[model samples]
Target: MNVPMLTTDFLDRGVELYDDVTGVIADDGTEYTYAEFGERVDRLSNALLDMGLEQGDKVALVSGNTHYFLETQFAVQQLGMVFVPINYRLIADEYEYILNDCDAKVVVADHAYADEIQPIRESVPADTFVGYGADRIEGDWHEYEDVLQSGAPESPERPDIAEDDDATINYTSGTTGDPKGVVRTHRTEHVHALILAHHMELVDDDTYLWTLPMFHCNGWGHTYAVTGLGATHVCQRAFDAADTFATIREHDVSYLCGAPTVINRLIEEYERNEPETTGDRPVRITTAGSPPPKAQIEQVEDQFGWKLIQIYGLTETAPLITTSNSNRRIAQTDRAADLKVRQGSATLSTQIRVVDEDGEDVPQDDETMGEVVVKGNQVMDRYLNKPEITHDAFNERVEGWFHTGDVATVDEDGMIQIKDRRKDIIITGGENVSSIEVEDTLYDHPDVQKAAVVGTPDDDLGEKVTAIVVEKDDADLTAAEIEQFARERMANYKIPRRIEFEDDLPETATGKVQKYEIREEYWEGESRRI
Candidate 1:
């Protein structure tokens, strides 16, 4: 008999084999074995279904990196309900849009985000609201622990969950308009977990750190992968170098993932603390977003004694299609650091190619730049409720291939290296910032005539969000003034860190601002373009 693929399979395998093994380590100072954790998941899953959450209902999760977030990930999907994890960094209005946009039936959040969610409850209300941990806001909500205990611990109603069932709707940043919800199925998420386990070599002995937010592509699907293998998950409430280092040592963390900006921060913290190095077992970290400069990679490895493995993908593709880790050729050679910064080859079973404007494969000389397109099992099904946009995304260039909107090249060894992004996106600290969003906010300033936003190379953030402008003839707008205007309109990370005012900006004949000219100086010594 052929068993259908489902994310719950991971948990099933863990309970069958590693029932006695520790499954999760929460920063809340609580630990649970596979058997206990599985019971809680069963109870929570039963609770939601018992509380009138029908199959296919959308449940919104709002929180940072915490254990409750991890538990909800498995619970909601047990009965085939769709889980929508919102980014905690978004403003109140953004949260309201996503909550209402997804038509969420339930809103589950931790007390840390009460200030943001408490106000939005009046505007976008869910059928049920649940809060966990201390300091929960005053609202119509039940405590998480109470709910978890209220449900039956035995197996809940199993709704014939299939691989093709609608699983998650991950909302990506909106550069032009409202954020688009990228819809993914169980098959996509299930395969992504397998790929992560295979490439990262996750085993029962590995203790994975929860440095990445569980909201980001379901923590890039590691929640399932690591838990399935019966490996211990060391969860964190926040990302601070001191706390992260303490957790790594405290839990004996073996692996983690983050952007280049995160690695930079860890490196800085490691130097200041001067902690005793990992003598026998070095921590392995996976870095993505803009590839870290080779020098930064070297610094992280040398200082912290952690192996840096780079991977690349977007939230649309179940978050991972390519990785730059464990290449035998690169590992055996002396130039591993240089090769590590390239996004490297496709992940297991993932097919990637660099093609020119006509969709033909670019030469493998690695000099010619082209758009990076890919076809894989893990690609998202489509954008939720946006059929036209989804059709346009795949109809471009190739018939079935998904356009990545990233410019890159393929080397003779078949390794793909990202050169730049075709879309006007600024990836600072691993977060995608739409340049158009920032530019629109800049234009809102009464004194601003023309504005352009671009990424500038920085030692920490990888790319610093920078804005260049052509001020109104008689108006004088300082960098601080522009930044203040932007902060009021957008998230803190989206605000321009550096702003420059000029009499006139270089523009094309059609009156479009040529951002490359403005961005050229800051990136002169850089190896990769945005």
Candidate 2:
């Protein structure tokens, strides 16, 4: 079958179809109609072309969620240039590596992050580095507003991009180590947007709130789907529980995507004061980054009455390979609480399998442990400048499956139960301990807010299990008390041997607890990345 040819074609469609109604609502009370936003995109594209940007050249965008980011994304694609969205949460050096690695030709950044780019001015050898703000800086740079004013509104010829042509390069947050460039194509992104829209039940009536950062998987394909569905959009400059609740009520937001940390914070805020500002009905929230505990899931549904949908993916999978669809069985039974734990099956355009160490398919006995492998149209084309590693990722001890490096078990009911990341499992005294299990048990404690478990160095036990915890502000809890809490909930060996408490844990911008950062503190003075 021939693959469909699709570019940033939806932008043109949206501009022609719904040019009158409200399209984007920014945090600073800036609102634009669909026609006005489309014209801005065209002007931005013309400005980029006037500066002599070439086709297929990489343009890096380092900023948070904003309307400008969306315009720049479409603008670059209009000129047939590839867009590289850098995670703003990365350190200066990591940011430098990505800019250098991808050989970005131009960089457009917001003024708030000017200090972030100042540290490594000479690191990225881009042709132009423009900052978006009121003040002007000296060098080969121009103000964002000035560029739009200087150039005439000209439509550059869109390249005849094949389905395999590169469209964007999104870097993983480097939770494990060095970030890898997950290259996505227009076709992949288009398909991913469709899958997310269909699986999440997003429709024209849905009003989307941009909660997730656009730099991450292109806001997990919401930027495309929301526009394609002609859904109203509400933007937040940053995450604030009160602000989010108010936005939901103000704009009547029907759908949003966030990490479990976002949900946990919102849930905590609701529990603290029972938000009176919210609408009569609960909003829908889609959460990923990590498998949330059943207790948290229950809290979200019971207290807030919000529909919590669980999804699973990496940057390489367009960040949406599977989603927990409320099936007929789950809807009929009273086991909605139990169903929330499973990550559920693959979405419409994805396929997944659980296999043993020898690459054979594992039986869905709900007890047999195996690695989860996937193959789908949404899988990334390749990792930029890392052909060897990309080839290894695809040929991960299997014939044709792309190795996820995640271990899981699928029950006969087709629900996937994630055991652990292949590297996260700890074998202590020949007994395998899923770090997720320990963390799940810790999450049951009322005083514990966020918990992460990792294996620390040990001479006798080979590996020791440790739990790093963050406590609720008003709740006073000690390490011994937490140990007792875990002892009552889990098996003897699975209990954490050591407990560490902190005001806050290190996290990626997407709110994933950087477990490697947690483990690094315990393994200091060692030469290993772990």
lDDT of each: 0.80, 0.83
Worst 10 residues of 1 by lDDT: 506-515
lDDT tens digits, residues 32-133, model 1?
Answer: 988988899888998897789889999998887877777788898888999999877677898899888889988888887756877888788586888885
Candidate 1 at 132: error in angstroms? Answer: 1.3
Best by lDDT: 2
Mind giving the per-residue lDDT tens digits that candidate 2 earns over 8-36? 76677667777887888877869988888
Clashes of 1: 0
Q: Which pairs of residues collide in candidate 1?
A: none
- Clashing residue pairs in candidate 2, if any? none
How far residue 530's Cα lies from its native spot in candidate 1, in Å, is: 15
In candidate 2 the C-alpha lDDT for residue 86 amounts to 90
User: Model 2 — TM-score against the truth?
Assistant: 0.96
Model 1 lDDT, residue 344, Cα: 84
C-alpha-based local distance difference test score of model 1: 0.80
